[model samples]
Target chain A: MTTSLKKFRCAALSVVKHDYVARGMAAHPRFELVVVADDPGVPDWIHQRNQKFADEFKIPYVRDVERALKEFHVDVAIVSPEAERHVDLSVRSAKLGLHVVQDKPLTPSRAEADRLLSEIEKSGVRFMMWNRNGLPAVQHAQAEVAAGRIGRPRSVHIDFYFAKDAGPPRGARKTDEQQCGWLEHQIAAHVDGSDGGLGSKPMGELMIEGIYPLAYLRMLTGAEVRRVYAQTASAFHQLYVDHQVDDLAAVSLELDGGLTATIAVGRIGAASHPSGGEIKLHLLGDAGALVIAEGKPDVGVYYRGQPERESRQRRIAAENDFILADNFAQAIDSGGPTMLDARASHAIFCTVEAALESSRTGKAVTVRTF
Target chain B: MTSFFVHTADEAPWRDAARRLHQSRLVAAAGEAHAEVFDGALLTKPPAIRAALEAGRHVLVAAEPCLPRVELDSLQRAAKQRSLLFALFNPDRFLASRQLLRKQIDGPLGSLELLRSHRWENHIAPAPLGLSGSLVGEIEQAAWFYGRPVRSVFAMQPAGLNAVQVQLCFGPGMATIDYCDALQGTTLTGYRSLSLIGSRGSAQVDDHTNTQLAYVGGDGPTGLTVGEGVRHLAAMLDDFASAIAEQRDFSSTVTDALHTLDVVAALQKSLKTHEPVTLEPAEAVR
Candidate 1:
């Protein structure tokens, strides 16, 4: 690695059904997708998908993770596997002294997330949880807070709704039909690009998508959540309802220094919004406030014969991936923390865990600290 | 069709509203008025409202009185015993934009799914619009649009901050009100955004669309002029008089205001207890 642009070789670890992260990393000039690899004991569909992605990129597909990491001589591992396998792959790659960039919802288990955090810290490898924190609007909000425009943000509210249908409506399924399976529906959802929470176990909206808004809150306020009170409902998508997971949720967070925050997240069907549903931030500071629409700096396209689904298409400029990649590279070179380090990611996971518990017990739960 | 006496404090926030009500065509302002319109004086002289009701006169409050539940019940009883019309002037309900939004909701917007209202004001110091009053007003506005009783209320007010965030659950649908009044700015301007997401379509009324920025000589753009001059108080007064003549209910009756007050009380209790307050359906007596 040099002060100049140091191009790094990136291993595509388990790009099964999710190649967006791998492709995003390869988009940057500093990273090159070297190989795709996963455990040989995994399912056949996983290997097929990995092979397909590897073939598309003209890279070899290896069945063994360790063998591929050692053979390819990669400097970074872009783990795009399921949520359950995120911490395992990241820890393995970090133990091999490779910087890691993993997917969202870090891991489903708290102990696993903590292990990955500890392992990453021990390895001294830069870890960046691929997030929307690098989006243009997110960056703008960060700049506003850093510039002291809002003056010690007192409250932060984020509305993150993904206007995409997961499956049938909440009550549309017949009483005699079989309940939807998590991995099966997720694999099917890939056809329409709605498999954001792709995994074996069922995940609520807060677990699958809480990181974005939580990262925004952490970035702006620089405070850890102390307590959380949450309300959840399976208001949409029978798939989530069948799994006893929430498609819509609102979480109230009490952070350090009495800074309060709220997050309203939902996977409300596509008909609810014109484009990708409203992603907004409402920040209240001691001296001033800011209301930001994350979809700004975009061009809206509407014409005859436009598809009725997401008819008013908003084409947002694509720079989040590049910025995230550049940030990771910078952190690796300078030994600085990435935009969202492993510690912050663990805190967000704990907060989400607490929110889930609060929703269950119907009482404010103190966030687990470790 | 009745003469109304407007009572306002020296620097009442609703003084302009009182003046507008006094200048309405259907209602006349006189010294010996048969009806009494109470503005910000409700905070200081709440007994005047009860006195007007007790004296067999109709009572109209300019803005949200934020009366306690017990006092509201007393006022309700006094007005009911005398067969007097007790109306609260909810100017937001009568705004042209709000009316248009309602029409859209009933027409093309289809069944409402989500509603979000953001009201931010640049009050250097704690001015007229307090947090509780604004919270009540916003809850009323949300209920008016949702047309459903709030099932639960969860509110959060950051310590040492003049702001309140409330999430109201209406069974399947939900509405959120994020209001902050302690915004610090050189120019005293406000921001309001109301978005209604329904099954079919969406309708939004954002103050940003109506605001104009002038790039004067400074480090940044200086002047932000919001063009909003909807005379809602006059319309409210006209409706009040028409309701009285036709023997019908005003657009926002005392029952609706009481329901709003109930929700506001639940929200306050939630703020204190740090738990969501479940509310039974409001039993309106009109």
Candidate 2:
């Protein structure tokens, strides 16, 4: 069932600009690109939308909940504020009965996180973040593995990176691009590598970036991770980072089903090694094994099976963010869970966060999340 | 059960150790005798931290308060596995004749829940009296900071290793922005003063001062260098952690660290003097 006449009037901020390769995804397709400017002025939607499909922009300061319902009259509201303010807007959007497509790492601290999540849950609005856009190769690999192209899964290793802005913060798209790092900038979604100053890179390298491929691994193998022992290092601390964050990181993670993943990641540092975003997802099962490196920026794979030689070449036709955006829209248009949701992001966040903590303190940090 | 090597002597003191650990299992931990001194090393070397987890066991430690800081931190992390590998000083219960922890166990991040759940059933408490509050705090901080699994080292009193040299590591490793080059030395050596590799590694000179670059000439990087300063601050945490635990005397480690602070101070001098020379001729402190 396709949403035929589902016309949604959308408005976003400049932050949505210059954030990703396919920058204006939210305004395409089903939603009519309505309001965009320096500051998203708050105009009461119900009061201002003289026509039902009319698009408009309002100053953020002037808009209030009542005004939004009375003047602006949009079906839902999208808030892509700064790093610290995402929670408030997401919560407010829910209270206003607007479906929200807020960005990643929704909140910096957990104390208020429950408050926000609880509010949205109660509001009954289909609340979601912009963490979609599955790396094309990652989607392909999951398909191949599920088709039994690879044998039993023993271990998995993954790598993914790009100019810090390469991957969307965790797995979402938003007009909001917050500064990354500082251990507190929850929305700062820079894919950290081995060079990531210290803790930041671990989450960026292993979890955020790795989540795409790792999620694929999880999808392929119906096994869950039980115990994890990890170690991290700040070896790349010497170099200066220009983008206000680290440039390299490495994580050694072991999953529940006897799978050991050794991931190496790096970003640009004053003395950082020259390496673009590269992800090597290695799946080791009982029968045979397969390795997929998103041929991005290079795409290559090596499979061990009936063939004497194992290799393949695939070109990345434009980025697949549209799929991610459309899927989220459709998920909202139809009340279904988006492929990349809070629960999955939280798992990746907690995993990477633990990895960073482990590497920094030389101890395998136990995540205390239920 | 997973087996563990712990120091449980009937004479082990439990009440005093209980004061340090926040958990209340110390005084009550007596009946749970894990192993006697005849049990050998507090921790057997094999089944590494990783293997023990694979086999479904734990590596629990109840050693002297004088145990090396690195080993303690590592043990806490190893406990995060399926196995229970943790340690902490416990309060000696009953009379000192039969050793036992008086109250609850201390873990890396907080309580011994992580290790307890994994079954590292040994109770370590009431280690040496001089254990620093910083040791507890930093271990706790790192435990919380990294979410590592940890427990208390249950024993009657402090062990012997607490001099001051190992204390150098209490500082942040050499990654300061200013001391740039000088920072390398900390990494070359586990810590600047931890230079004594083995009994025969180098000069016969021993003691915390001589080895640590705490002399007149050895300064700069160690002086107020960012990394060195960080290490120095890390050392400060020792005072803080030990104070909270009430286990350590507080002088030797802190005073020595301050004295050695001259190492970094003098090095900065050498850089300005543009000439290389021994910081203090190595005779004054010894």
Candidate 3:
């Protein structure tokens, strides 16, 4: 296959980096990792790790975004910063006339997302979110839906449940000043200003972690979320002390076209068996139903009086971040619309924000559509 | 030695199995000379069951006993007081799939985290069985593996009584059983799938068309083949006869059946309340 290689640069703005994005872009046939711009807030250890990654990929690491933009002359910027910094990084990259490929939650809040979109629109630069669900299986499901395999979809069910983090970071000792610095930065990044710097509460986790399944449902059904009713609770995880965030949440959504969907997400204790996790998505249409049961154990090993054993395999479709990057390159080259553009990300953010509000108020909230 | 009698409704699914068991002398049918044997459908005919129990006849129910809680409880108490050998026939307990699952659970399989069983049948006919009726056997199978009483039950019948999904929470683990009766345009009898997930290993028994057992974890992927015919029914009848003649408890006794019934009852109640229903402790039943 002929390769249409494009120069790709990334702004490593978040302390918590996604290795998959970097690896995926590097592995893509049409993309070349040109430069990595490091933000000031990134810790020293993270910088070292980023440097190692850049060196291994034969790319230069620049501490300043302006320097990288001017020196690398890149075509697109893969902005994988923290949720709050997404807009700032995207707007800066857009100002340099660079198309954008950004991570999830477009921005921490809808207002920031609007500003970021306005910048990209003014710059006339192509933009896409790293929607991992835009992979083969989900796209195939979308195709099946379009082909009338299941007729008109009436309802959708999506669930994502995983084991909670074992515990807080071990052997972590920092001065009061250092701890305060980290806490302040995290609190500012939180859209709701509820971040205690420990971890995201259930709502935040749902917005970030649950967005994949939600995005998949949206892509498959092609329905806008109209209203949302959500219920959330800190069902388990006694290890968390006074953590107001919920450990379990269930959201019912009414999509624009009279399609209803339910999204359930939770951080429960690990399965006593070898099963890695449970992710189920079922779409029921007037004609028939499509059921996708992912992360189910295909093989099980049992030893008497011991935990069940099984191998956990990553969803092959989810590993297509590289494909998303490749799509970004193609969109830039051909001047066409990408699969998950800024408008789609905006709608996803609105639905997720609505669900968060509904959970907090115990009332169904209407999703704001622009 | 006590000889038991088998009585079933003419159209009962187990009638042929009962006849086979009687022919093998594992059980005796009630005839002129078998006056010591019982009369009555242990599940349907309560009046006849009372009469037979009063006559000191050993009785075996060739069907799932679904009686009102009070009546079933009273009968169980009366049977215990009179030392009557009463058995509820659930041949699933004797299926090769079930036996293989039990052996795996008891030996190689570690502590179970979850177990899921699905059974689909066509409900177009005028059969008295619905989703809950079809699930009695699966519930017993799960309980046997759990080795504990179900703590609670949450159930939903999304398609009315035609389809049901029940979630049973045991002490530390849980199980879910989904039963559907809406299968159409299928000549096959039904579909049955079982999986046992534990910490150390897991196994799945697919008893559709062929009895296929596959396991992983402890000793790796071990496959076992077993028959899917009358052998299970024969084994169940053997247990019943042994329980009667040896005066010993059987694998699936009236109490065990009652436990499953209680869970089903709780599940049914949960369906109405839209909330999980906690079951009475197993110890309280006796």
Candidate 4:
């Protein structure tokens, strides 16, 4: 086919010094890294190290995230800022006619999330969510289902675990309006504040406390969260990930086919393994079932066998092949989809939205539960 | 709830069986041949089976039951609704069976009333679901006269060395691959997945999937397997074919082509539910 759009520059909003989402984009095989942030918050040693890495890699380093986009004339801006600033950045990117690969927890609110999604669509830019980690067997199961290997799918089950980084630098804490605008700044406060002598924070923040998990659920289901019930570790007091976030939750999802998916997730004291992220999904069909015990091939699944449950002893396959940088490369080469497509990413954000709603009320919430 | 419909090609042994069956007048019929349809299932007509399916609907058919699990499951869901399993049988015999009863021909429409009065409605439904089953052992070699074992592939578990015979079955794929092609006739299938305990059952002889059985140490070297081996293949083939023609005869009580799938689903359910399931009474024809 003809070249749809060839060779476009891209800007990242998160400060360059932190090897976070920007790092993901840089690693993609397709896209060429164009520009990144320059910040004083970056330690002298870290900045020197990273700047050299960026320079050696032939990527530009700019002081302000927005300035980098305006000067380079990139076709897209990866909205990697803290949850609070996503809306403004997304709107700005859409206005610039720049396609956006937005980070999840799209926005703290549904309306804003919808508006961003609508604008991106109207701007004629592709949108997608950014979920990393080979994630074990999820993709393979999806492919198998599409291939009709398994009959009509009826149920889906997911299990997940995550740890927090309490001592993050710069905009790490969910406080600055720029860093975590729509989300409340209650990580350490509410967690520590809710200790025996302390009381829970009266102010509710979606980003730090509720948004991520809710958005994630919505994204993975790839459907409107019709209804959901979630119970978080209500009285979480221990500090594990530098921040005191409710580390675990049990959530149930009922989809269109009268099919139900139950996800068990939460944080625990020191991990027994080295998985920073994980998702275990079991897909049930008429004849048999395909269980994705590991999210990616790089991940491993082992358990102290349950009584009646069979010993899960299979090896997970590899899917760590998706590099974030390729989003730009794909956007440039095939004129097809990039990992950073806009609406799909919005969907993932919407999941976090519903999850947050369910957690706060101690009741099941619909995707549009607003 | 499993059923098997045996078909014959003007063969004497089967003809004798039919003639003897008619002569005995016990569950017998009088005509050029006797045809019978049966419900043959254990579960309450599951919703999946009810939407469509009929018995004695086809003739001259074949069945291939070795579908990948997904297709198999889908078919089960669909057939389970009607509380029907499937096997093929001859259309002519079935249609003939519905005609005037030779012995009780006192009045014209007497047979209809008698059959209807007996709830033979299942006999008139469209043909049931059908599939092909591959057969490995040479059917001809195992005939009464030839009686060869080494030639019978899937043949194992020697019943008796006195008269000495063997026949083993692999997967249903080899049983009906070539004949299972999509043909003009409707097809019904019977798959008996029985676990006989006391007399002649072996664990290796799982009925639902294809299997082998040996009649070891019989009174006189077990004339059983050799009694009518060649026709057995034809009879099995005819059952699948007849269902495709919608002409299965509803004259016998034992398993037939129409009830094969029915029986299998039931037995499977038994295995699943840990309870014995039974088929419902056949409905009266409309």
Candidate 5:
């Protein structure tokens, strides 16, 4: 019997928000891109971008999401839209019995996240949140823990910094200058491909990129965050200051099994680092400690005219995409859980929410269970 | 030459400092010395330090398991009455690498933006040396690097856990210190990493990176060396002698020691209260 490939649709604009997930899933032979779909209510620019992605993939473009889901009979719907639309699109696709691949920052709203999670559980559809846990460094760390190389984990510290410039520096604007519009600035940020939280809502660095590292903590320790004490600052960018959101944040977490962890995250401008940024994990166990630089397992390249921004190209690159896609496929084939399920994603979301609250209240906040 | 009477018990944990003091050529280590060095263990017996000051002997006390502000003030007053130098010994500042880092701060690194230090050990004593006290030296080191009073302090320690994480902001620069003594091991091994990020450059002193490993035949590579520790005591002794001979203030004064103690106290309070502590501007110290 010939094995049938699962058809998937790129559910939103690949041109605007992100196309990496779609391309990664396509790299796996078991999954095939069939159509590009979006809601008719989206702006014309989104439709244009969707159509461009469809043309690039040699697939059909449908403005009506429901019509596209019904007509194409796609097995998976990969959704990467504005931050707020993530839940709605995923909920729509899951209710149609299509497995969903949702982008990060899951959603800014708690209720919406619950709604999508409920739909996924009720419909018995698989859901995977795009994350960096599939990277080789992360995999090695997990394997070491599994092999009992470092014994039972006691504490972990992660430093996740994205060394990217975000427009003008803080204090560059005049005292009387008006705050920049969130939507306009985000759209403009897209020109440099630095818009992680792509929406009108001004989500901070913790909101946008916190999921990846939090997911790492969950994946490595298998313990949920119980409580968190956090501190935040608007240090690097005037945009964050204007929006009153945190561009830099540090959180100390208490977890089950007496595991203590801390995370320091910031979009510390490009000049701070040679590579894209430093993503390091420091884990202490019963027997010994391990320090893993996430950006490592890469080769350093130098030449006369190399862009100062791109210091070293990643080695064994994009394997995370392929690995995550394969894991999802295996989960689908074996009736197992996805690498990052909706509940886990929701837990991470709640952790970030608690951190933000901790920062605001100047106290430790208990993480809410989904 | 002036001399300091080494007044530590033979079995004190700071045998390295005592040995370095004995080996120093700058100042003779004698029984009838006009100055004295007090081990951190003697801090519990405040009268010994007071007696040394009352006898007109300058005194240097180890700044660990820091004394309460009141006790520190009493010692300061005793030294003032005798017109003798009263100093706190923070040997980390004397590490060759740390001296280079301090020099580089103004030489090539320019104004500092961030400082982070992580220390993990397995052999720390219990009680009085709780998570807060274990971080006093690091806090002093951070203040020394920034050369400014801490603007605010935030710290976290999970209940029944053997770790403390603190964030200190000193003007435009910020420092984070993580001290964990929860590791389980039979042997006494300590690992620390300090990184400084400045406007012009960044440097890190990571024991993990600095470890020289040899893979002859074992389950894993054996650590040949893990950076400096005992050797720094000699430099600290030399500096202390120079400070006494030159009649100049020591690298860290009693006032500086009090400030470090206050920071530790505030951190302990913040750990209990779950709130960031904002410090008032400190009074200038002579």
Candidate 6:
């Protein structure tokens, strides 16, 4: 007997070009990149990058989602938009009977997330979230714990620290319409804007960057967070005077089965390595412990000069982005489980949202199970 | 010469440490041709401890004190009043790696941000001294490194005494001390590691098969030899003899032990309340 490949005609929708995903899908054996949908509201520079990405992938570019859906038969939509826009784009794709692969922070709030999740369930489309850190090491750790190597995990501690400059770039110009976007609107809505500095460009750092670590914790431990107590501060980032979005956040979670996990995240000083950050996850159990240190590039070059010089380390293994795209493709073709799905993504968002609420009320908040 | 009376029992954890002190010529052994100390019978009896205290002999406790709080308190008061040294032997504090760790912390690792210490024993022994007695050494090391008492403690013990995870907040930085005795028999690495992260640099000392201090920043990837067969008990004995001869404060004292007990007490209380326990200066000292 012989098996045939199930072709997935893919379309990528983005405000900024996610060329890695575009390139990854184009390179997959079963995925054919048919369309690139660029939002017209994005800056011209972004559009230029989108055109370049489309040209590199040899795919036709569409200016809007509706046009992409009408012009091509897209089997799946790879949506990488601003956090607030994920729901709208994902819902539209699902409604058009297209499977969805959306970026992190599935939505800014739970209500929008629920709406997107409902649409996907109703449309019966395969939905996967891009969680690149669900790597082999994490899966192996989980397997070991399941195999009784660690013997019933008792607690987990994870620390994630990144450089301030490592954040997404704030473009040259800011418009009034842009200020109404999720990132800016969140600052004005949740925080007092007395200094009038530019709000965090892509919402709070916890929502933007914290999701990956949380997802990794969930993936490793397989423990659902039951409650969260958190403290957040805008300790640094003097650049954002108006936004009270937290640059530093510490969240303590009570997981199911009496396991406790604490996640500490901050945008601080530059790391010595090129990864621009450091991650340490320590999971303790009755039998043994698992310690993982990520963000260390495989090879580093050091030089002695007037001021000195060094290149950030690069990993020798295949990039996580490529693996993530492959996983999405394989899940769609095999009708198997992806590393992360809508429910897991929603749980991450809820945990982050609970952390935000805990910071506000100075108390622990129970995560809403949906 | 300061006379020393070694108290030990059969299978005592610190018997070898006490023997090292006697062998190092740091003190004059004063009982039973040193046969009783070697046989490990004298220390298990309270009468011997009382007789040693009365004779003004500096006593070395070769095991976690199984005495009650009142008796331990009385012993400490008598030792202080008599000006006789009473020290609990914690060998890890005397390791060459510990000295190098101190040097790195005091010299190159600037403005400590966090410290993590992990110690996993091969057996799940009951806390004969107290619930925190087994970890008092780790707590003392943290205090020694930070140069401050633990101001607050939060602990989680999911499996009761089998495992304990403690988060200690000091004046300068924070620390996590995790102890587990689930893994039995000898394994690679022995699962003993200490990590110090600071603003200027970071250092990790893994004291398993080979004791080495690997430090980065200031001077990158500097590996220092933590002398093989370097006797930590001997180093501690030297400190004890010098302190006694000069009539000065020793490296670790009864007061230090009390502080650890207080922190452990607070940690135990916090474990029940599920809230952080704060330690006041007066209470810590008292």
True contacts kept of each: 0.44, 0.00, 0.03, 0.00, 0.24, 0.08
Best lDDT among the predictions, by candidate number: 1
- Tens digits of per-residue lDDT, candidate 4, A233-323, equal 4212223223334444545555554545555454321121234433444444443344354534443355665432222333445333344
**TM-score against truth, every candidate:** 0.90, 0.42, 0.64, 0.44, 0.88, 0.75
Which regions of candidate 3 are displaced past 4 Å?
A1-17, A65-76, A79-146, A150-323, A326-370, B1-28, B32-57, B60-65, B102-109, B124-131, B135-144, B149-162, B165-168, B184-189, B206-227, B249-286
lDDT of 1 at B11: 31
User: How does residue A109 of candidate 6 score in lDDT?
Assistant: 70
- Model 4 lDDT at residue B127: 21
| Residue-by-residue lDDT tens digits, candidate 3, A1-370 | 4443535554443323455565666677666677777675666754775687677767778888777877877777777655666788888888998888777667656788778767877888899877656566666677778998767776666656654332321123233422324333344434332232222322345665566777787778887878766655444433222345554566667676656666666554454224545555666565555556554323444556663323344344354666677677778878787867877887788887887786676456788876
User: For residues A1-370, could you state the per-residue lDDT of candidate 5 as single tens digits?
Assistant: 1157543444442345777778778887777888888888888877887898889889988888888888887788888888999898888888888888888879999898788778889999899999999898999899998888777787788888887878787777899988788777877777667888788789999999999889899999899898887777777778888999977777788898767888878887777678877787888777767778787688878888888787675555537988898888888877789889999999988899999998788667899876
**Candidate order by decreasing lDDT:** 1, 5, 6, 3, 4, 2
Q: Residues B36-114, candidate 4, lDDT per residue (tens digit)?
A: 3222221113232222233321112222222233434553444444434433222222222222122222232121100
Docking quality band of candidate 5, CAPRI definitions = acceptable
Give lDDT tens digits, candidate 6, residues A77-133: 888665667788889998998888886667777898888877877888778887656
Q: TM-score: which is higher, 3 or 5?
A: 5
Q: For candidate 4, give the lDDT of residue A324.
A: 43
Clashes of each: 1, 138, 17, 114, 0, 1
Relative to the true structure, how large is the alpha-carbon lDDT of every model? 0.79, 0.36, 0.61, 0.38, 0.76, 0.63
Off by over 4 Å in 1: A1-5, A310-317, B1-28, B31-36, B40-46, B54-56, B100-114, B124-131, B146-152, B169-173, B197-202, B222-228, B249-252, B277-286
How displaced is residue A3 in candidate 3, in Å?
A: 7.9
Off by over 4 Å in 5: A1-15, A176-179, B1-28, B31-34, B39-45, B99-115, B125-133, B143-161, B166-176, B185-188, B196-203, B223-225, B229-242, B249-252, B269-286
Candidate with more favorable, higher TM-score: 1 or 4: 1
Of all true interface contacts, what fraction is found in model 6?
0.08
Q: Between the candidate structures 4 and 6, which one is better when assessed by DockQ?
A: 6
Docking class of 3: incorrect
Docking class for model 4 is incorrect
